[model samples]
Target: MTSPSSPSSSSDAEIVVVDLFAGAGGLSTGIAQACEALGGTLGEDVRLVAINHSEDAIATHEQNHPWAEHYHAKIEELHPPDVVDPGAVTLLAGGPSCTHHSNARGGKPIREQERASAWHVLHWIQQLRPEQLLIENVPEFRSWSRVIDGEATNDGAIYQQWIQTLQALGYTIIRDDRGRYGVTLRACDYGDPTSRRRLFVIGSRTHKPTAPEPTHSADPEDDLREYRTAATIIDWSDRGESIWARSRPLAKNTMQRIAEGIRRHCDDRLAPYADVVETLGPEDVEQLQDDVVPIDDLETAVKERTEPFLVTGEVAIADGGVTGEEPDPGAVLVMGQHSGAYPRDAQGRPVPTVTTTGAIHHIAVDAFVKPRNLPQRGVHSNATYDPGAQPAHTITARNHDGHLVSPYLIVYNGQSDAADVDEPLPTVRTKARHALIEPDLFPWGLDIRYRLLEPHETKQAQGFPADYEICGDTKRSVRKQIGNAVPVNLARALGAHILSWNTPSLSTFGGGVTADPETEIPAYAEVSSTDD
Candidate 1:
């Protein structure tokens, strides 16, 4: 935050930016990168003011964007005039809280309590009157509505009215009505390694705003750079708990999913097609050939297939329930949490958009080790997370829903792609990714080793720079910040696009009125919180 009153802050700075509902500096980082791309040193030439209601989020953002001024309060409480010079901010940007309009809420109508967060941006725009405004949200935000004048309006009335109000304030709304990504875009197109999509709305008071072009693509014919893959970003060295020696053991379905994931993903010649049945639900198994053998056949088959030595809850007797002190040698092959029906994803592909639930989604690994005495890493402080069942929102990193555990997983075991019940699939990232081990290459007694993706790997997948510090006392806190972030590469692309429209065409472009000598344009009504 550059104080206009401070002589050294921004008296001669090139740009001033304000981020409302700024979550962990995703947008700010990208904006700073955009500034650098445009040949400006961030600390000297640009000043960023970040505001958010979450104290932890504010701390995280401040730590990462150290040069920026941060406010740990809601946007509505801060008077724009007191925070920054009205005319100094060339760009005003932020994604309002999308909790109300997310598709996850289903068709529930937004109550009064849920509407004010998004509407607050209009007030800031009126007060700050920046040359440009950029807003981000989930696609369902367009369907928002409110009760106006004692009569319920259409489903999208609130958004329509908001847009009209923006137009009234002499701002040009930049939109893309056609194409694959009208206003919503996939982050992988901008070099993010995940397959997350977001909606962006850009407005300009002076120049015409355009969408950022894609930098990477899935199709080679497009001539764009290839998408960054999960394999490239993941730290292979950080495999978490070994399947062989977990303090607690894997769930029945989870072990089954790993068996299939290793069989299919590792390019093993004799893949685990029959092994998949061992992990499948009754529905899937019932559909299989009647000749398919039951668990009774697993032990004899294991001796021949060189496959995973699964120790599930129901099938523990197959492996004699394990060694008294540790897993029997030559027992475990690969282990992973069940994320989706696919179970395993190719390493050379971007992961799905990261989420705040660092807990519920278990980390996975596929490795085989010789039975030599290798020292084990101490259990992580955050390992207290219960692998038992919990609500979806609890693990989703909301302020107060979960068991306060850092990272956990909702292990979905079964043969079907969507074997789990009611959980949103972990974006596009595969569930149990590859950790190859050829049994023939190793002597008999071997260890099974594997781990989940570390916080840093998840952060990088979301496009945050490696050195950027996420401030929080706990792993859950750090995950909350990362999950809530906009992709940095996507943000940078948008920033560059907005910056390209730097020249303000001051002649009232929104409603075709002129600022200098044309017909007078009436001022937009200041919407009160009561109206929200």
Candidate 2:
């Protein structure tokens, strides 16, 4: 075993980081950017050593960070260096796969092997005894229980054991007032457009690093800047025209369901306003043309003038102009309600939590008539939004599936601003595809077009640089890499905190002031001796 009293050299000023389970280098990118922002050289001031089991993820990481030394292998297979130099490694960081601890998995039996993967950090820590250790995962990781021989141990036993083990190794685990060992952070608080809440366990051998302060906020009264919206990161003018994968056609059954759903919704909306419409005059009806018409008055006009005159049958085109058709009472035109599928508002609030399934927007009917020839293109459970105001939802790996519901923002009649439409973008997922509703395409209601988000857009939504390369052979592989990654801005903020706390100029050998070793009791010993 290496002694903790190893002498430090001039080169020790540099912050050396080891990233385990590094997925596409999101964490590394943030750390590197943070180092540079703090007036440090990328390769010299902070060196990175990354390891991952997936070859594709490693390839992506390498493409983005060419200077870092990367290993494409499982953590169990790699042996830590035997020669341990105390204070040589500034930080050891990584998040194990969260499959077993994720709430989204629906209480599936925990995979003991995967849960045990966290032990790899202990193994490396034992070998290197780094100054600081950072672990990121879902919130449930703190309550992880041990499973031995397929039998579950005490609840939170694994987490307790980990804390105890770190304490025994001469490290102080940072905790909150509730004695919680990890700090939960939201990506939006750090100026990332996506709202991803993740737990971070920061342990120090000497000084306790301060928790990262939020630089952005959802509340308007706070001094901090408002969270970045989806519109800020995404290039609306691009429209993904060059990318063929952006739009997909919905299946016949899915379209029929959406059509029926819209019809029912319209009936509900128009029912209340039918009686009030009879009392309105021509001048009162003309008020509907104004953008700021009252909701009550608009409802009356829509039910009286719009609902009563529904077009039916095939639409005729004369020199690319649409010809009006007579009303068909038998064909019901329906508009979809705000079903909360694609939740958004015009105030540019932070997006909701991103899941493996993308956000789904409700499909609404623009007109109340069934056209003879309907466009055969639309997505299932997809969401439509006002493109200018809402931010993109959280991007997830499952976005590759077309059947899943996702958000779709509509740009109506060449109108660029969607601020008038109130709503926020729902979370982005890998499988949820989006559907675009075009009223002019179909004689009845609106024509819906479906498509998946482009890889670049997904990267942007996750706070990655727009020019960042997503190195994967297929879009699915790329989506998976992006989805599993930590938001770049959040990681950068944490890294900056670590760097600020460990600056040699500001403190002594251990970075900041540390608790005296002689006065402390072993956390593990105390817990072990306690009775239930």
Candidate 3:
């Protein structure tokens, strides 16, 4: 076992980091950026050791961060001493597998079951009590409770216990205005293209930690930078092929959606075969316009503001453009043919173009939820626990129904079906659910093209640079690594806040304070022992 050598010289100013469950180096990249932002050189002043069990993930992390040492073993399998000396680690960071606790949209599991949870992290923390530590997970993780007698005693009972234990171990957790133990942040607020909401629990042994302030805003009135758009990260060079020249013809339902998209989104609004217009600035107009020579109707030709609209159809175009197409069924936007939405090649790389029109804002499926007041005797969930309400349902002997689900998240609520190219992306998922909608901006007769958002695109959206390489044997694996990452910009913001605290009340070598004297436990806190 070759462990990283301990601190060559005992410089309290140096930063040593060990990233547990470091998926594709997102947090590591951000932390390194934060360190460099503080004027330190990599490998000399700041060193990193990344840990993960996934082969491809560790390979990806090693590819990007060559300066850092890596341990390709599960968190529970590796001994802390064999990985690195506890005394040398200044910062310990992790994003333990959230597959079990995260909402449906949040912790979509990778095929290879990765079951390490906060317990593994807690065990490791007990072994390597670094001066500062931060944990990242889906916001719903705040509700995780320990299972006792096959039932949860209370919501967040486990999390509260974890925090109190850390506090007892001489750490000060960051708190927000609402007295929440951690800061909850949106990725896009820090200029990341994806609007993923995540919870970050930051604790420091030295000084009080501050939450990073938002640097971008949805509101234009704020002095911060405007949120970035999906169009910004895309490689426009691959505009896709002409709609008429596909190897396989477009599907009937898909063509129908395309026609509707044309009617509602384009038709009178766009010049099918004209010069592409320059993207408009906010100061530009009531609706974004095209200055090209449609030569006929300048009024009808301008695109109706942001994002590409329903593109085209040979049937509709041949029929002289929308002969009363059912008042346009809200622009037929269906998901892709594959289970995860991406079409792969002989080797699993996501193809840039496909035969179909792909997913667009031109169509919508009527979303439905089971009526809350169906005049029913049926139980909404097993956790609701009126066994009488659902007498016919299987009653498990364990009775740990609350552990079965977390009925939380805004999967479709408050979010658009498809975001405009000019707007921030919807939350990136573990699967390739996000698809591209490319409009035939000019007279190429291509109409609009669709493809799953490429891995590189999603990576850049997470604030990783274009050169960052993601390794995987298959397409799903590659996408999972990218989707599961902490947004680099958001992590950088958090890292900056922690690294900037220069003066430690006591040496990290000798711990002093244990949490804030004024720190308030969260309202959901049930600070009780496991045996209680």
Candidate 4:
């Protein structure tokens, strides 16, 4: 894949942006990067006036962008015309409440609630009236109709109405070859690394046939760079297998085994949402539903096995020494292997592009259970692990029934002879298990061996700064934030291209503007750094 170019060097070359419905500032963040690439600062001449209804999302936006003024109330509460610095505003962008347009747009008997959200995009644009405007929504919005009677005719003709209003306001409409609303841009084509296709409406004072020529391309051999992959920003330095700087020690043997499995069992190393079920204990199954495990409890288990115990005989304990026979074959062995990967930090390669499925979480080898006595159970710990060359499956958000579908890595014993078991094997264990498991045997110990991605990981992958705090503490809220925000890197890439295409004359404006900054003016917003 082509490496991303360096940020623009001139501070005075900034471009200003105003964001409406700016949930968690994904679009703003991406625009910031683009400004940087074009040799400009996001806050100086290039500003981002962001607005969002969710307090939690706005809070996150403020923490990252202390300079930008944020409105935490509904879009209806504020008068955008009063807040904008007209002359300096390069872009006016809004992705209004699209839930209705996306989920219930064409459904029969449209409710009144649905109509309001779908029609609000243009309402906000009229108020902010920047030099340019862009609207993003699901591909389905192209054919969306406001329902009237039980049947679906053109219904309210939402698409036609939007186009007309934009034109009436002297805005030009640009459509991609696909004929979707605005422009049909494949995010991956711009080297986002993820296949997130979005419908964008870009208009400027001067009518243009298209939005902009794509700076990045999907086909490596067709003039554009190769598309990026999840590995690009994974930060695998300390963690052998990650794209980032953390380390989770995998057994040398285990790594080799996993590699073999990937080659033999998987059709592709980066299988998206390929499901694998490790024979989990009743407790793990419970933890999956509950969404948490006692960290202290799991950590203690790893501590005990730091050094393989002499399980053939009794060992001394601080409380007292106890003697014992070989461990029973029936006793399950839980191994705590190292599963470290990824050191999250914004300074690393820019995060992967963001997506609607950004809320999806992955399963990881957070903790493992290794029985203190392995020989008695005829199990041997793997000694040679190689993470750098190995990769786990890709993770996606859509659920399969109730199961959070994602990739899995499971390991089972190769020995299942009658001699190993004193009693006949249970019938249930025989039929259900990973193929890696020996016939008639259940997977006794499953480490992350390999696992799916997590929402936090997804956030990192999607170009949010590593430290970009996803506001709400609840999983559902976190998912919403992640899912809603645009990928900062992708936005930045596109922003930089716009600046390159339109090298407008520059002016100074780094400090807060006056009560009424001119419609076509530039000013800086001064800032003081804090150690905190």
Q: TM-scores, in order shown?
A: 0.64, 0.64, 0.63, 0.54
In terms of lDDT, the poorest run of 10 residues in model 2 is: 413-422
Question: Can you give the lDDT of residue 32 in candidate 4?
Answer: 74
What number of clashing residue pairs does each candidate have, in the order they appear? 15, 26, 7, 45
Q: Across residues 394-428, which tens digit of lDDT does each residue of candidate 4 receive? A: 11121000101011232322211111111111111
Question: What lDDT does each candidate get?
Answer: 0.50, 0.52, 0.52, 0.41
Candidate 2, residues 65-167, lDDT tens digits: the string is 8877777878777665622344478788899877677654544566688777888889888888888878998787877887766545537767777777887
Tens digits of lDDT, candidate 1, 74-153: 88877778887777787899988776666544345556566677789999899879988889887767766765553334
Residue 374 lDDT (model 1)? 8
Q: TM-score of model 4 relative to the true fold? A: 0.54
Tell me the lDDT of candidate 1.
0.50
lDDT of 2 at 350: 17
Which ranges of candidate 2 are over 4 A from the true structure? Answer: 1-13, 82-86, 148-154, 233-394, 400-445, 502-532
